[model samples]
Target: MNANDNIKIDDLKKPYFVWFEENWVHDDVLHHHQKGQLVYVESGFQYITIDEKIYLLPQNHAVWIPPNAVHKTNSHSEKIKLMIMFADIRTKNSFYHKINVFSVPPVLKEMIKYAEKWSKQMTPDHDENLFLKALFNELPRFVEHSLTLHISLPKDQRLTKVIEHLHHHYRDEIKMDDLSDTALLSFRTLERIFKKETGLTLSKYQQMLRIIKSLELLSAGHLTISETAYEVGYKSVQAYTRSFLSVMQFRPTDFIKTIQ
Candidate 1:
């Protein structure tokens, strides 16, 4: 079976294969790869809903989706990507068993780019074969980044009321007086309760929520980068880019380029 047709292990000579594409549109269908797949976006916006956790596939960052993990890729009209599929024994590390993100290390990039070049070379030379095998084993150490902001859904009626308000009005420029009146608690009391329960101040939680929601929208490609930024309460594109790049390693436009 062709690796392009579905995840397959049919080719011995081509134990590792890379598929590079631009302007690809994928329907949101749940699927799993038989082999571990490194889904990297060189540029563009895409969302990978992996095992129920929503992850935005930002530019320059790859989601190291493990074998047998059910996931779906969401895109608008365009996506650009490079996928490296590995066989059973070829992977460099046996320790990693879950999805992870690593910095785009130089060695990894050269290996992939070399592989792309090899594909175009179309030779069956022994040296070329050895280079590919060595490249697979040369896969560098992977580092993971924690993107989750701690949040606690409280059982208290007053705090629940405040939480519900923030959820529904993430776009609004919320004010202290408005939050206090809605929660029916003084600002100080609300602040104290939020800190105790969620480990984040009330303002911090709201900002986190807006950024997370904005990320979701940006991933789906439903809104323009600037428009989505504004929808999540950002007053300007620069403010939005700063927040997005702070959490994710790439700018919004770079992200949009990869998903295409």
Candidate 2:
């Protein structure tokens, strides 16, 4: 379901804030809103595609999306709890202009949960205003715990095709010559464009994609460590473990333990 299909941001009042929590999967079409948004994932994962770039937002993380930034999302997992809050342009602060993914501190999480609960109740106007004030104060602190996974997507048509192919065939050992042929670009040209557009070499981009996929698989609790390694194209568990550690800063087992 496309959440933006029915909701019209222009119709809503300015300085608006709406909270939502749900456990469902949605593959939304590319869409944008006039107001900035904050999306918090309590559990599960949300893949947000913006301007050809894809952001993998896992549990206990939040992403701040600037106003009118066209994006789409694909939710993974059974219990994809999320909180979405929107703010008008006039009310947006300096931090709202860029995309930021950060660890959801305990205080901020509690505040959002409280706001959700309070909104459901018929609270007095004064009490609601107090909650809003608190929320505003807490939002600025989010940047302090930011995560550095802001991946960029290629704009070139040929590079875009290469990325798409990699997404589909990440489990296989794809050579640069194959990618060059698929993209219809000379090897050097393809390499230059890939690095310039994404700030990552083709091999590094593929590795990051595999690690992100492995995170989802491990979090789901269905795949063993070795199985995940092979599933994501690694020939051995040790190699996969090393790559995963480099990208995610923790072992797959440690990540699984935290989520469990």
- Candidate 2 at 101: error in angstroms? 1.3
Model 1, 1-260: lDDT tens digits are 12234433333355455555555456578877666666656655456677755565555556667767787765432545545445344344653356775445555665666666544232245665677567545543534342342235565677877888887886777885678887888888888887787667777777767776775576556789889988899999998898778755677776555344
After aligning candidate 1 to the native by TM-score, how far in Å is the CA of 166 from where it should be?
Answer: 8.5
For candidate 1, give the lDDT of residue 211: 73
The per-model lDDT (C-alpha) reads 0.62, 0.75
Candidate 2 per-residue lDDT, tens place, 70-178, comes to 8888556777887776666555467777888776777788877776754323223566666766676568775675656646877777777898898898889988678
Evaluated at residue 169, the lDDT of candidate 2 is 89
Model 2 regions lying over 4 Å from their true place: 1-5, 24-27, 89-93, 118-125, 224-226, 250-260
Candidate 2 versus the native: TM-score? 0.83
Alpha-carbon lDDT of model 2: 0.75
